[model samples]
Target: MIKEIAILVYPGCMGMEVFALTDLVLMANHLAKNMHPGKFSALRVKLVTLRPNPVAIAGGFKVAAQRLRGKPDLIVVPGLEVSRFGEWDERFARLGQELKAIRRFHGQGTELASVCIGSFVLAEAGVLQGRRAATAWPFVSEFQDRYPDVQIEKDAVILSDGGVTTTGAVSSVMDLGLHLIRESMGSAVARAVSKLALIDGGRVSQRAYVDTALIPQNRAPFSTQVNRWLAQRLSETYNLCALADAFNVTSRTVLRRYRQETCMTPLQWLQKARIEKAKHLLELSSMSVAEVVVAVGYHDLATFSRLFARETGQTPGHYKRLFQGKRVATFPRG
Candidate 1:
């Protein structure tokens, strides 16, 4: 039987999420039909929308999807562009109708999958209740607070439980689609599709891509003060006591406020800033690994290297080489 995959697009949806999954699914179907001949069945993918009208997305373009027709085998909900904290709440609030639709489709046995912040919609629909899920890292804390019963795996590239699959960040759309293809069409077809799509088949975590500095700025007053202080001195050693003294607060207060804002301890945040600076130096400067380590405020080379590897999933040297425009791998020209 041909598996039906319905990708739901919405107003302000992130186009990359929708297209990435759609293209991968289409490629999987193509590879299955051509290579395996009659050995495997193909997949039918549809761009579905709640309303039949054209919808404007994050980019400047508009898309028109078929008004969700009959229930499909799976429903992939793509995320929207959320640049502010309130945007998350606002989007879900305005999605009452869409939420109802999702619950209805799920009740009819349609499996639900979400990409990036799309998991928020699944949670709002109550489909992710009592299930393990994942979403873009920045929203993990908030998602947890809103859906207390749902388990959020912030680092996982893709997570599935009880027919509800959730993927982290926009790039995970490819990984999630490939996962589904593998499950339905077998590993062989999944590999063929991955190669055809030029995506890594082994990507299973989003930790390497997450930049702690790029995590949305914390809005709390104390967090803001701490952010300013850290920005000015990422290359210097800092102590929580000194920071608290400088800000006229107790050490515990500093820790509490920073944790509330960034979801990391003061020391962790300092390390994150230093590592981010080190990355910039590695990518742009002629400094050696040892020089780069000291430049990022680490006096001990071993400690810096270990911390860098742990946070980035790559050694300092490997990361430099990877980002220095060196060709790590070459693919046949399309």
Candidate 2:
């Protein structure tokens, strides 16, 4: 069985994702023929462009593509290179045709999938509304803020719901490609392709890869002021009375106002801030876990360790191990 796929291209799309996805699909076909010839299945692919002319992708690269050549079995939306917040709207405004194409294909019963911030397009097209989806980690808050009706699977590397699939970050294209092959050709062929390509198919969660410093801050004025207070005194002992006093409010009023603005109590917000700080020190500084605990204003090492593990889905030592010896590693100069 050969499945038809229309890989959508738009301006500012990540070139690596476009090539990597096609490369993975080609490898899957090669592996399927060798490993599962009897039940062989493959994807017949085509590149579709939103613009009539050549698509200008990221890093000053241009890709030539044709318009959609009718409905396909699946439509793949690769990630885009998003430099900052608020730029998403500007970018999406130019993707009117591409967004329409996505909506049209979905209405024609075609399965849809997006990678990284490409989920933004699907959400903009309204197909991801009322469905559980996953987007790039740093953009989750932004995504949530923009599309309040969509359910974001915060940690999953890939999520599928309502005939739509979404994957985290650009690198997740490998995982998404393997998943497509596995759905049609079976896991044996996918496993063989993964082994040949050195792509790990067992990736399940993006939890450990999260960097809280990249998470957007809550914009509410009260939440803003509260966060400012926490940042200035991250090493100070917590005292609700003092915090309330700092804001010139009663403790009960502080709690009520904080919950109203941030949906979390004052203590919870402070703990989150502390954990983010601890993660940074653990990665960049040579601080011991005990020292990190004290640096985050927690005297009890065990409690801080547990909180770190809970927030990051890995122990402080384990998280540090993942980044060991990389601090001084330099990249080749361009």
Candidate 1 is scored at a TM of 0.85
**TM-score for each prediction?**
0.85, 0.88
What digit string (tens of lDDT, one per residue) describes model 2 on residues 1-334? 3398788888888987788888888988887777667666567778888686788899878799878777778888988777777788788888888888888889988999998888998999999989999998888888898999999988889999978999998899888988988887888888888898888899888877887767667789987898899889999998899999999999999999899998899789889889888888888898888888899999987888888888888898988888655756678998
For model 1, the run of ten residues with the poorest summed lDDT:
209-218
* lDDT, candidate 1, 1-334, per-residue tens: 2388898888788999988877888788788888888987777788988865798888768898899888798988998887776566777776777899999988988888999999999999999988899999878878988889998888888988988899998888888888989988999999998887788889777666666566566677877778778768777877778889998989988888788876888788778778888888888899999999988788998899899988888889988887866656878998
- How does residue 10 of candidate 1 score in lDDT? 81
* Candidate 2: worst-modelled 10 consecutive residues by lDDT: 321-330
For candidate 1, give the lDDT of residue 100.
Answer: 96
Model 1 clashing residue pairs (backbone):
none
After superposition on all CA atoms, how large is the RMSD of candidate 1? 3.8
In model 1, the runs with Cα more than 4 Å from the true position are: 219-233, 237-265, 326-334
Best by TM-score: 2
The C-alpha lDDT values of all candidates are 0.84, 0.85
